[model samples]
Target chain A: MKRNPWRDIRLHGTVLVLVVIAELIGTIKIPITQDVAITIMPLIYTIILGLAFYLIKPIKWIHRKQARIAEGAMMLFIGVLIAKLAVSSGQSIGLIFEMGPALILQELGHLATILVLPIALLLGFKKEAIGMTNSIGREPNVAVVVDKYGFNSPESRGVFAIFIIGTVIGTIFISFLVTFSLSFLPLHPYAFAMASGVGSASMNAAAIGPTLAAFPGLETQIEAFAGFSNLLSFCVGIYIVIFVALPLTEKIYNWLEPKIGRESIMPKKEDEEDA
Target chain B: MPDLIDGSENVSVHGIMNWIFLLAIFSIITVIGNYLGYHHPMESSIVGMAILSLITLAGVWLERYLPFNISSILYISVIGIILAFPGMPTSEFVLHYVSQIELLSIVTVFLAYVGIGMGKSWDEFKALGWRAVVITVLVIAATYYGAAIVAHIVLVLTGVPAA
Candidate 1:
């Protein structure tokens, strides 16, 4: 999802309609279980965008095409292998057999999974990686307003790093604060909300996956709650990010521009090696 | 995968009937199982993944025929769905998972055409152009500590011992 850069008119329009339909389902409160059926449109959007090119266009035996099919299979393999190993190792250590080697082995699978998730993600999103990634750092096109803002300026890049680090620190600080407050106040259980809140749902869940398994108790419950809550919140968060967050961010940028100075927002010249 | 695509060998494996057949079977079984209330037979995504993988292995090992691909689709789709929607319980995510799998599958095909424009910074966030990072951080912090303190505050107010 991160790498997609294409803005195909048909694809975008189709996905947009599907998302609208999905949102409408949520609004209607369908008994088909909004949680499950709500996924229909997003999935449909994704599949249509994906399979549409091949199914409708020149590629008839699309699935048989080596180039694309290979990548799909490769990704499927990586995701499955990581998930499979992580689960089997964890199960055997916790449920079936109790041995240090077995336990370590299982833990390794979990660790590897956490470490490689982002990379796997990058690979899977091969189509949009460029556009999406650029959309993040700089204006995708000159026509956009963020254009006047220097994407190549030093301050812009440096400030970006500082803010990201700050967010990470903030996420942890927030989690710790919650723990502290729990000792003194009555609070609603976060469930899976907090973990996803820390970052993306997949990320927090993967990172804490091992901890939750190894320590199964109230601690685990809290993580599960955080994971679950985060997952739900993530869906809402993405929309807010696109609509509310991005616009609000621009407003804040404009407000700060006079005081912060134009130079304050300039992104620094990055090394070619890094690129 | 770049190699696979760029490779000169053109030995093609037509999976049209295979794809249709497998998709049919997966939809049938998932729908029937879901309707029958075998919802979430596996407790966790991890466990469910393992179970499905095992079934996939069985199908793959059983024959070189179409069932392997069908099983593969179902297994991968299940994992993809869980990864995409972390909040969804396995029982509640049957159809949801299948759709994500197909979506991810399609996107994965074009991954090679893309590249990352990495920017150098003192940290991971360096080169990211945004002031709203502050709001992002602040909101996250507020939510985290806010929940924690309130939970504790309630306990103290109620005079319930902290477990």
Candidate 2:
């Protein structure tokens, strides 16, 4: 299909429209505790954009390659905001140190995903399913899995499955989970803010949204912490997956393959061959 | 140096024009959003948008020139931070105005694009079958609680009271 340039313009321009609408809703105060009411803006604009994207179905014009470029460019400005937050954060060096244990713990939590491998194995998932569920289902995981296991490997299938899921629902899940935890947990909001970063920008934003809304005063510190944590995860996460996460899953798979007695856990021929 | 200039000369006018157009639209959205949301004066909002545009442009170009696979977002973020750091000459204006820039709007738009991208890949996602659903659940469980557990322990150790 020949792409329409005007539609391309609107597609890219949608963000601008949503920004205006979000400005109109402004912010709302939520009572989290006595003497502390966190004011969070209702995400009306996001909900509206989501509804329009699905119902209106404006999924034409911009080619995939072009969209990727546009997304990358949009993210660049977001990054600038993050950097600004970081600079603001640096002024309060005490908060940085005060938040250290929380940051490290969260990174460890991100790394703790290795636990999923054994669970998958014990659940009778084929050897191939181990790699996919064990690491984050992001782009880099896709690359690493394809590189080591080959594109057609059972491992690749597992990775692809999780990647789709993560792409579609991961941010929403993270956002909700963090918000729910905040109401019940006794931790400082800063801890949740750092934990919110978790590598993916969208996921970071989603998780941080409630936290920022809850403590609008700390937006800069929270954004900066999340950005920093995300950078750390991105920089170190790939290596962890390649050297530790993937390899460890492989070892666990080998050990559990015997216990399952080579039962055909794979449902399809392609998965069997890949295995 | 001569080779670099030759390469720069080969840059297409269409690409640069597209970039400029995108930047203009972004600036317009930002200025209007700032004026409406924060109730800032229109003049200040325009000034703020101009500064943001320049910084963003520099960031886009820097990403192209810089080596390695670092994200453009990180590059732009560093540039914004350095230029607007607390004692810098432009710190006051940049900090005061940039802070007014609405983040959730960009986030919402970004996610919407992501959704569209996912919709494009719908067929591929469907092909993964049921196991994909199971894997997704497990991955979410591990990640969400994994981070939460760590935070819980650390906070408790630090003597922070639970809510």
TM-score of 2: 0.53
lDDT of each: 0.30, 0.57
Over 4 Å off, model 2: A1-8, A12-94, A98-105, A114-275, B1-14, B30-52, B67-69, B116-119, B125-144, B148-163
Superposed model 1: Cα runs more than 4 Å off: A1-224, A265-275, B1-115, B119-163
True contacts kept of each: 0.05, 0.33
On TM-score, the leading prediction is 2
lDDT of 1: 0.30
CA displacement after TM-score superposition, residue B131 of candidate 1 (Å): 12
Candidate 1 structure quality by residue, lDDT tens digits, A165-266: 342343244334444443454443332223323333222433343334333465755564454434333222322333443344445434543443333222
lDDT of 2 by residue, A33-77 (tens): 433333444233443453345445454443443333333344333
Residues B1-163, model 2: lDDT tens digits: 3332222122221244555665566566666766667676777656666666676667567767788755444455466656666677877777676556544433444444444333333344455566566667667657656666786678768786533
**How close is chain B to the truth by TM-score, in each candidate?**
0.26, 0.61
